[model samples]
Target chain A: MKPRIAFFDFACCEGCQLQVANLGEALLDVLKLVDVVEFREVMSEKWAGPLDIAVVEGSITTKEAVERIEKIRARSRILIAYGSCATIGGVNGMKNRSPLEEIRRTVYGEHAHTFPTIATRPVDQVVKVDYYVHGCPIWPPEFIEVLQAALQGVPCFPPDHAVCVECKLNENVCLYDKGVTCLGPVTRAGCNSWCTNNGNICYGCRGLVSNPNTKGAMDVLARYRIPLELVLNKMSMYNACREQGKTP
Target chain B: MRYVTIPADKMADYITALARRQKVVAPVEKGKGQFAFEPISEGREATLTYIPTILPPKKFFMPQYETLLEYDLHEGQKMQAVVELEEMVLFGVHTCDLAGIACLNTVFSDRPKDLNYLIRKNKIVIIGLECVAYCDEYASCALMNNHLPNGGYDLFLTPLGDRYIGHVNTYIGDSLVEEGGFFRDATGADFAALEEVRRRKREVFHDEVPIDLDEIPRIFAHSLRTTIWKEIGDRCLSCGNCTNVCPTCYCFDIVDKPNLDLKSGRRIRVWDSCQNERFAKIAGGESFRKERSSRKRHRFFRKFRYPVDRFGKFFCTGCGRCSRTCMARINLKETLAQLAREYV
Candidate 1:
């Protein structure tokens, strides 16, 4: 029997769903591999029943999102965080910079009374997430691979190694060696050093590696002559989930 | 075993003959002491003594951009895994680059082997050239223990006065000798000549930096909290040149390039750098090492500390490419010295 697959979204750009569609023909292959009973982005028919796999995107910000996620969790056997927002609180977590009330007032003013809000957090914060396909816009190959693994009844976890491993394999000159700073060492792999391959530095989108040598990455940047505060600010961009203590 | 002489005059004959039989690539002068590995049909095009090429021979094993799979949307998501490879004799490879190749071999050959890389690697033949002296002030091969031939090649050649002393390492190399007739077995005298070359190399290739290789990881370990990263991060433009030029840096990104028809595309693996700002950013916009200092520290630990713990060896290889290519004037020796000073 084909595994029942569903996709859920919370407070996000819904870009992860677009990225899934970007998979083009691979999307068809994935549909053949599993029964996607509930992807709002692609399907009109909605299945309000139990699911074998639920791919949840975006971060939770309102009470409704939390309750909705709980419902999805109760019905799904496996929950896969579909993007950085659903897994790591993502850029949405940046709102943690201010108190929840102040942020609401800043955005809504008098209208704030009508809108309910909460600190944004990844889906895993509210429910048990069985797997994660991490990235700003989920890497299609990784998403497909993890989906295939799930279908095969194998546990699929994001790679724990740093980007340096893949960078060394590509044998490109180090950005630091060129007197530039990079986040390859602390950032998780699986994005396969995407930005770096195109002559851009790693922005740490895949999230931090498990037990990353944060101090070590700091020293190398210093040796390369990067400023400490700028580096901190850079790290703070996508790390609001870990910083705000919202990560499960 | 006998030491035979083929005068320098007949060098072209041997090279042309080799090229005719199979593909031959050698370091050719690009300009101003700079050289690159280019296809060579004759010996005159080969630069026997050259600095590390603009790009290491790693390009042969893993091209900057390679297609791992080709897919067609016209026929129900049909895809074919393809490998573009050419059988060639890579001649004039320096000892340091050979060591670089060995590092790559260790990586791609690991579990879940990269079939794309392995299949391409099998088609190429390595012929290493000995470095009698320092290539430049940037090289620290002696400290890294990559100055001498370390058996990554099938044949190693040492220049001996008017001729070359060739060490055939594999059966394939032996077959080349049997077919080419340009090489003869080495005698005791030739072996002695090789030893003399080694003795001379010891005098020429002293440690470029004063720090001990074994203590490097420790120095980096203890100096993590030091202000060196802050200093370097201040100047870092986040250009990612250092990772791009590094001999062992192999981070990559995979993407599918769809055709104009939007029906067919290929999954390409391209060279990636960790120095970029977006490398770690995931959907929803969370970045791990956002600081330049953190990213900088990560690169150093990867070269000096992390790999040592994981692979039981330093990943730096001391090729000096990173230092030479850095636009920020980041000196590897100075960085190491500063770390050593702070730790000690």
Candidate 2:
């Protein structure tokens, strides 16, 4: 029997789901391998229970998000975090760097009291993540590879190296040498060094590598005369939850 | 003939002639003090006086990505072994890069030989260029003894004041200059000029590091438990830049890319690096080289120690790309000097 796959979104921009939709011609191939029982973005019918695979996107930003994700985990045989938000809390976690009350007041203005907020946490913090497809909007190639691996009943490990590996393979001149401060040295790869290849600096949107040498990255920044606070602020853009080391 | 000469003015014509027959790859400036090996149709496009290109000539041989096989699942897993080959003349290659190519040849040609690399390597011709002066501060070619050519190329060129003296090492090199009609027999005066350049080169180039070359393996062997690994590791970003830019470091990973049909795909070999955290990991969830320090130590050992035991040769060509490309500013020569101080 073909494996049943479902994609769920919580509190994200939904760009990751769009990446799957934007698969273009390859989406036909993906359909041949599995049955898409539930995809709210594309179809109306939702599967009730007993899902073969559940791919989740976005962070748990509210109490309701936590409860929904846990319920989804209970019915799925394998749960894969499908983006930076689901795996590392993503840019949504930047609210965690500042006080929740201040963030709520700034965004909601006078209606701050009417809305309740919670510290952003990755899906893995609330429920076990069987696999991870990591990036800002999720690199489509990795998503397909992870799905294929899940169907084959094998583990698909992402490249645990830094983005500089892919950047060098592309033979792009080092951005640091171009007077640009980049987080490519410590940020996890699997995006094919996309930002750096396009001449933009790495903001560490993929989060730090498994064994990031942060001190070494800091020294590199210092050599380029880039300030520590500047890098810290950039890191918080997608990594405030991981950096804080808070237990849910 | 053992020696020939090409006047400085006629180099462009010779280059254009060679490009007419096949691809000619040479160094070209990429601005901001960087250069890369690119195909050129004119001699002026080749930067003959440039430093080592950002990536060595390895890209033409092994390439970053090469398809090994194509598979179709419609026939119950039918696969065809494939090799992508290119025929070309690699021009203006520095001696350090030549040594690097030689190191790769030894590795790929070893037991359980890689037919993919060997098959592709045979199609290209290598033309070497001598470096009479140091390229920059990062180079340790003199220390590694790779500054001088050691039988890795078909032809070698040494720049003189008004001309280049060429040493033809193979019949292919002989016929190239002969058929092109751009070179002439070297005269006695030309030989004297070449001798003068070599004589002065001895004075200009010396070991950049203080330690002797023979002591390197010994020092590395004893320093396995030393603090240098931690010191270097503390500054290493594990970015894999050092390995990717390294001319002699050749590790790779194999992956399959399926087409939109899901039944057809190509298996490709892509370059991998030891500096990656999972490079040493096994399927049992135990990674022997889990620490950043251990991975960094493994890189150094691969170049200085393990290759020596396995191949009886040092894999380091002293091209200095590792130090130059390192974001952490970890200098290879300085690290060697520290090792010499502690373990020599």
Candidate 3:
């Protein structure tokens, strides 16, 4: 039987789901391998049954989000964290850098009391995540590769190396050589060094590697005369949750 | 085996002749003060004097990504070994990169040879361009002994006052110059001019780093537990930028990508780095080099100490690409000088 797959979104722009749509011709190939029982972004009929794979997007930002994800874990055999929010709390976690009350007051204004809020976290904080397809918006190549691996019973994961591996492969002039400070060395490799190739420095939107050398990252920033507060702030975007010793 | 001259005025004609002779690939300005190895049809297009390219000539020899095998899963994991190669003449390669290519050849050609790299290597011809002086302050070519040509090319070009001398090292090099109809036998005066340039270059290209070349291995061996590693480790982003820019760092990992049918796939080898946490990880979820400092230490040792013992030569070609590309500003020369001070 074809494996039943579902994609769920919580508190995100759903750009990651758009990435799946952006797969273009490859989407046909993806469809051939699995049954998309549920995907609110693409489908109207929601499948309510045991799912072989549940791909979750966005961070658990509310009490309701936490409860909905609990039910997703109960019905799915394997739960894959999809995109940066689901994998590392992503830009959604930027709110975490500030006090909860301040964040609520800033966003909800006087109605802050009516809505509930919580510290942003990845899916793993609430339930076990079998795997993660990570990025600001999920990387299409990785998503397809992971899908293939699950169908073929192959072990699928991102390279343990940093983004510099792909950047070097592209033979791009280093950002540092141009006097631009980049974060490619410490960021994970699955995005294929896209930002660096396009002439911008890595913002580490995909999150830090499994075992990030935070100290090493700091030393590099310090050498460039970048302030520690700035580096910490940049890291706080996707790393606020992970730096606190959480997993996805 | 022989030296000849390509008149300075006819350099453009010489490059055009080389183009007609074979597939010509040389350095061209990539705009905004950047340069890369690209195909050229005219000498004017080639930037003979420039900073080190973002990537070494290693890309032509062992591409960023190369397919190692093709597999069919339906027939119980049937696989076919494959290699990709093309013919071309690489011109304007710097001396440091020439030494780097030689190091890669030694490593990939040893015992369990990497036929993929070997097969791709032989299809291309190498022509090196001399660096009259240092390319930039970030280089340590003198310490690594790569500032001078060491015979890794079919032909080596040295710029003289008004003429360029070609040191033909192989029969292919001889034919290229002899048949090109642009080069003639170099005179005794040309030899004297070449000698003069080398004599003056000795003063210009000083040991960028304070450490002696001979003491590098010993210094690394003794400083295994130094606090320097801890300091660099603490500051390092573990971005692996240093390894990617390094001409001699050639670690890689393999993966398979299935086709549309999901039954057939191609296995490819992509570049890997020791700075990564998982590079040393095993099946038991235990990583031996868990600390960033240890990974940085391994990369340093691989270039300076380990390769010297195993390959009888230092893997570092002193290209300075690593330090230049380092976002964290981990200057290679400064690091070596620090090592020298710690153990000298």
Q: Can you write out model 2's per-residue Cα lDDT over A1-248, one digit (the tens) per residue?
A: 88899999998989999999999988988998889999989999989879999999999998988889989999999999988888899988988878999999999999999889799988988899889998987889889888878876777877778898998888888888889778888788989988888888998888787777777777788888999999898888888889655321
Select the stronger candidate by lDDT from 1 and 2. 2
Return the lDDT, model 2, position B140: 90
TM-score of 1: 0.63
Top-TM-score candidate index: 2
Q: Write candidate 1's Cα lDDT for B48-112 as tens digits.
A: 88888767888788887898899998978799999988899999788888888877878788888
Where does candidate 2 clash, by residue pair? none
Candidate 2 displacement at residue B63 in angstroms? 2.2
lDDT of 2 by residue, B1-344 (tens): 48999998888888888888889998989777889998998878988888888888999889999999999999798999999999999998999999999999999999899999999999889889998899999999988889888887888999997899999999888877785788998999999999999889889888699988899988997989999999988988888888889999899999887765567889999999888887888988698987778888888999999999999999999998989888788899998999899984
Worst 10 residues of 2 chain B by lDDT: B256-265
> Model 3: per-residue lDDT, tens digit, A1-248?
78899999987889999999789999998888889998988889898899999989999999999999999899998888889888888888888888999999999999999988999888888888888888888878889888777777667776666787777777777676576666676677888788887888888888776666666566666666778887777777677887555563
Q: By lDDT, who's the top model here?
A: 2
lDDT of each: 0.78, 0.88, 0.84
Output the better candidate (1/3) by lDDT. Answer: 3
| Rank by lDDT (best first) | 2, 3, 1
Q: Rank the candidates by TM-score, best first.
A: 2, 3, 1
lDDT for position B236 in model 3: 73
Could you tell me every candidate's TM-score relative to the true structure?
Answer: 0.63, 0.93, 0.92
